[model samples]
Target: MGAVAKKELKQYFHSPVAYVCIGVLMALFGFFYTQVLISGSSSNISYVYSNMFVWCMLVIPILTMRTLSEERRNKTDQALLTAPVSTMGIAGGKFVGAFSIYGLAMTMSLIPAVVLSFVGKPNWGMIFGEYLGALFFGMAMTAIGIFVSSLTENPVIAAIGSLGIAIFLMVIDSVSSAVNNPVLSKVVSWISFSTRYQQFTSGTFDISSVVFFLSVTVAMLFLTSRRLESRRWN
Candidate 1:
């Protein structure tokens, strides 16, 4: 699995996709960081990572859009399919590759936080919780992207399809809150990215949310593996 993951990681770095994804994420973070934070006013990140919801909505697709699709499109999947590896191995490799890219982007974004800590007493607790939430969010998004990638041979289609679903989840907060129906709103709110993750940024680490994210990530990966198996029959 390590060897397979390494190969997948290498492919990501070899192509321009990884670089483009990280660059776009960082650039957007910088742009949004300024808009969300005004100088000399609290100097906090209440809205910065909060606004990351939008970035995740669109970027997860870009990062995962090519995972399996490129292989199918190039017919390189034949080698993988015929290899002695299991379906879980293939899905795991792709998930690790996507997760690594997301991790790299998150690490790069930390430069600003490191810089800010020296000048003021930054909320380390909140930062830690925020990254935790981000990790879960990114993992779940990657899982979704991996599944999308398995569905099509076109990277463009994979990205767009994943993006559509991600965007829907991103705004579930507003939708659920506005509907004013207790039962339906509660269900939607529970599924909302902001609602599920709000406790993290609010300086409280909730185990249930963490577990939920992991469950979703695992479920998507499991589904992706099943899909790959089904494709062999088709």
Candidate 2:
């Protein structure tokens, strides 16, 4: 696991792709933060966060598109499959690589909060909670992207697949809200990934929200491992 993790992390930083992804995300965040600042909003990042999720729809696919798909495309996966490494190790390595960069992205996101602090005493607790929520949600999104990357050799297809799933989850909040049946809508809201993100901006710090993000991440990573294992038989 350590070896795979090292190799994966190296691949992430050594290649120009990882830096490009990070650059794009930071640039987009800068753009959006400017929008927020210029709009003269107060005590409400819910709007920013809601739109930020849409940005993920574009950025996540870039980071995840090549994860496993590139290996298969280049036939490098043959070595990984035959290696003594467990399927879990391979998946774990990839997740760690992606998650590490995501952590970087999240930490970078704090720059605005720090700046805003000097501008006026922003709600530190709420901002921290929002960053926490963004980190967890980013993990889930990357896991889902890795899962899709496992299914195809085409990087473009993997990216498109990841984008579709991320966008679907993002829209579910609205879907739940629009539904007619109250009970069904309530249940749907529970499942709607974006809905869980609301607690952060609202400063709820709900444990259930954290659990839901982690749960999705675990389930998706497990599926990714199984998918890789299936390639052994193929």
- Top model by TM-score, which number? 1
For candidate 2, the per-residue lDDT at 131 reads: 79
**After TM-score superposition, what is the CA distance of residue 154 in candidate 1 from its true location, in Å?**
1.2
> Which lDDT tens digits does candidate 2 get at residues 1-234?
788778888998999878987887788777776676776663554555557766855687788888899999999999999999899889988988888887798788778756755655666777788778888888888899999999999999999998888778877767767878899888877877778887777888889988998998899989989998898778
Please report, as a residue range, the 10-residue window in candidate 1 with the lowest summed lDDT.
34-43
Native-referenced Cα lDDT, model 2: 0.82
Looking at model 1, the pairs that clash are none
Model 1 has a clash total of 0
Clashes of each: 0, 0
| TM-score, every prediction | 0.93, 0.91
What are the lDDT scores of the predictions, listed in order? 0.82, 0.82
Cα distance off (Å), candidate 1, residue 26: 1.8
Tens digits of per-residue lDDT for model 1, 1-234: 566689889998899989998998888778765563446433466566787767865888998888899989999988887778788888998899889989889878777677666556567677778878888888888998999899999999999999889888878778777777899988886777778878787878889888888988899999988988887667
Q: Which residues of candidate 2, in runs, are more than 4 Å off? A: 39-47
